[model samples]
Target: MAIIKVLKRENPYVQIDKTGIDDPNLSWEATGLLTYLVGRPNNWKINIAHLSSVKKNKETSTRKALLELRKYNYCHLFEIRKGGKYIEKFYLVFEVPTQYDEISSNMDVELKEGEKIFYVKVKKERNSNNLPEVENQLMVENIENKGVLPNVEKPKMVKPKVENQALINKELLNNNRMNKEKNHEYDFEEKDDDLRKIEKLFKEFGIDFSIKHKIKIKELLQKNSVDFLISHFKKQYEILKKKENVKSIAAVMSKHLFQGTCEVDSSFLLKKEQENQLQLQKEEKEMKQLNNALQVFLTLPMEKQEAIESEILKKRKEINPQIKKISTFLFHKMIVSDIEILLAKEKLI
Candidate 1:
């Protein structure tokens, strides 16, 4: 992290209105120092000597100003060491006044840069001869004074609309009765003979007669047996009409037989199974090739083996080097002596 210093355009004393004090001897240096300290970025610590020169006569005044500024909530005072020396460091700590009473009269006044159209009230008093003492005393008095009472407003009440429970219940009952009558009418209506035949076909195939199953069966029927089944049912209906006890033409037609067809070609399924078996065989062959490569790698010189081991160790930083060596041996299915034999043959050592 880097320390960032922001320079304010106006003198700290002028910004805080300390220059306008009646006493010519009044030191506004403390006010300026406080302003600067408070304005620093949070989490930064500074030494007291960094503020001004250390002198016996000025030391008491400087210390007093720092303390006074803290009392007014302008800065946070603490001790710190800078450049191997112990010193006091002040941190600027400004908090928005929770109450109007918390505002200080002697402090510099300015609208916050981003604030708009805000007003506040302050008590006015005659300027006294001991301006610094008067200012200090006023600050003390303000801190001691109890805060003002907060203003509170009562919320307004609203009337709710009244509903007739009896009327609502009667309307709900009428809706239910009308729905029941509609359902009864639908149940008594005659079903199409061709649709009945499709249903019978699903039953013959031992398929679940659910809504989804029926939809699937209908789609299959449309693609396959729709025209044949309709013609067969019409013929059955004509034969039944010749008999005297025919209760319904639709019912008689509904007795006709149905048969379904498959979408997938049988030859296509056999071809797909054959391709899957070839893929499995190819995978097995690749495994055998990897095993052969490992065997060849193991039959190398000791020096060559060490070089490869070092490379593997370096690459496997997060893993234990010993565990990695054991894993490599097991993976390749070769011993250390095998490595030396291969290395000698290749003249690598």
Candidate 2:
């Protein structure tokens, strides 16, 4: 395949570190999500719901990508509390992972009057046996003597001896492995329960699910709720019952449950058209009956119409005492219904 590339030099571009984009630990989804988040303005509020609302970004996928970012330290979630009550939570995005504390500590040295604090930054080697780097420090001296204090000799560092360090490490590793296995077993049981529940649902609908159906249901569950899946299944079954040559409901469901496209036969379309026509005819008959009732009510004496309206209002208030007012449209609609019942009893319509 031939490839063509074009570059655009524009102000509407985000500058991201190549390290994060090319990180092996992150998937493409996570990398793209990170870049999108980093490009937003500093004051822009961050939220999962808003992020998921973007085109082609679903809540499930966005949440999974966020988990990946959090795992690699590309993002951090913090909760802000006040008066020991939870206020809100926020996320912090980083170009790369670095070791630092959220809250900074003050220097232990005392400051003299009229003296300024001189802070220093130190870069330490990664593997060197030295103290960690300090972000801020004050260089203070005893001012009473009018001279800088002499440097004290640094204490020699020592490593404690552990006779069974190797055995301890092995035991810890074994314990970690056992705990992981237990967690895995629990997860497997939960998945089995979900699968069985889905199977039970299929059986309740008089449908048998195959291995393929089971796998598809698992995938559907990842992006949809069980209720949604069941609703779709019922709709599909209802449609399939009307279509001829549909041998297996489960087979058809595996293809079209949550996001599948369905094609109905001409006969099914004809049947649906007939059903719609019947519905329209039924509505027209009801409308004619209602209009006849309204004409009869209008011809009645003023006192008779008022009696019907009062009866309706009394019954409605008896049922719901909180109803203070009714709209004109609804009141007339209810008046028409009461007139119809009254005329029907008198064998008028």
Candidate 3:
């Protein structure tokens, strides 16, 4: 996989501030290195180091160009450690990469008799997703100092209308009065002849009878019997109660809510049960270990056992890993150790 062609003017040129290299403070070698870097892809490596010393001003020219780029916030240098050695590379500061010459892992460059450049590629799949970090400390520090975080917004909250509050309270009290007349879950169990009974039944459940849920109940009642609707609603209510997921009295009344669906999707509850079982198993394992450790300690000589307990309670774990000014984890660990030692000592006595 090699192609050799005569190098000429770029068919498509990059748009950059060419006058940057002409600055009086910049070194002469910076202009050459900048041109060389802009010609290659973002994944390119500087090849001027391999040139003859007489023809080149040395690799310091390339270093100066890199320094200029860093000073202007154009790119960032990343050092990766490999085999006890460090390999340095530069990545573009901006997200959009500049790539004139696409690079591959085994690709190499060669100069021809003329000013032609050759590209050699050992074909391989394009690597994506696990790319190097493009963002640097400059981006983060700038945001921090300027108070510009990635996402900062307040959540919109629902507010009750003031005028409706008194009316809603009165309606709720009336509904409670109507519900008290009938002790059953649904009062319209045998009285489905009139829509008034159905409306009262809907109001008893704290649901609005004027909504689409009222229409839904009417349709279901027409299709099936009143007993069927009551049975289904009870089943749905039981499922919600079992999961301890009764969101609100309002949600139970709305057709869009889970309670209105009248379906026993136990998979959600099963997933929660599985999680609880795993947590219980972990807790049992920890208790078993603690009990075993206590039994072992009790078998030792009384003075040695007391010495071991004292040592265990006195020596704290190293807190080097903590970077916070005050570590709550270390404080909690100390409290837990004291409780555990006290309990074990009481059991032995």
Candidate 4:
């Protein structure tokens, strides 16, 4: 018979079952092992070193104690496959386990004395100490512009305040200047490009844009677009090249070009100008009609205008079924009416 034992302490204690203490079938060694195993968590696994309680305890004595414990059925000792071979495992079942493989992988398997378990590990290899670290992508910055001993003191960025419209404009101007400087590092190339365009335009117009003319044209380009100045140059070149000079070119520019009186013998330009004026007049007349229509439509009730729009759109479908929306239908019809008036005035189809 074994005697039940309760080892008590100030802050901790262990519960030992009286069955292991009083059972006559268990030897003293088995009883001691059973008492130790029963006091542990039911899911914990016992090892040889755990059975021996001391660092220098003999492995043979621990093995015999385990064998004595197994004979009395206090726990289970079994073999299982781990890393491809059979290995002995102990399950502190206290009672006989129905499932032979009851020892789970998560069971608290005790380690041998002096065994070190490192949860975190350092890889053993060449330069193993210098492992790569992850960092934020946007946080990386150039240190060269931050000044001397930059690593000692981080560069502070003070946001430029915009308290008023003038301050806001000043900040925007500074930002634009910086951006222009950085992005356009080739202003000379841009100037050369403009000169190339001017040369090409002169080639197209069958004239030499002379060095003096080039200087004057570059000055003009500061305010006018390349196409606008070049077109005007073409017009003046045609009139002055007929007059026997590029310096005489200034005559047309100073007198007629600025005053909108620069007329050339070009039937094509005249025709295009007339068409543009006629188109402008047509648009103005359409706008006037739309305004008048809007006034009359506004006088009617909302329902009446909606009904008239429906009827107008349905009629417009006879000309082109593609005009689907009421707004587009009315706008197209008004434009067509104005175009008809303009055609009648010009006596064209």
The root-mean-square deviation over C-alpha atoms between each candidate and the true structure, in angstroms, is 30.1, 27.7, 26.1, 38.8
Model 1: per-residue Cα lDDT over 3-58, one tens digit each: 11211222233122233233243247644554554344434554445443633324
When sorted by TM-score, best at the front, the candidate numbers are 2, 1, 4, 3
What does candidate 4's lDDT look like per residue over 112-222, in tens digits?
Answer: 544432221111224235645344211111211232221357689998765687987898999999989965555445556776798787666555557765666566666
Model 4, position 156, has a per-residue lDDT of 100
Cα shift from native, residue 211, model 2 (Å): 45
Q: Rate the local accuracy (lDDT) of all candidates.
A: 0.44, 0.61, 0.47, 0.50
Q: Report the number of the highest-lDDT candidate.
A: 2
Worst 10 residues of 4 by lDDT: 1-10
Stretches of candidate 2 above 4 Å error?
Answer: 1-10, 100-349
TM-score to true structure, per model: 0.24, 0.27, 0.21, 0.23
Error of 1 at 130 (Å): 86
Clashing pairs in 4: 1-22, 1-24, 2-21, 2-22, 2-23, 3-21
Best by TM-score: 2
lDDT of 2 by residue, 62-105 (tens): 77677677667676554445555554555545666522242112
lDDT for each residue of candidate 3 in 225-268, tens digit (9 for 90 to 100): 76666665556555655566676644653544324455455877
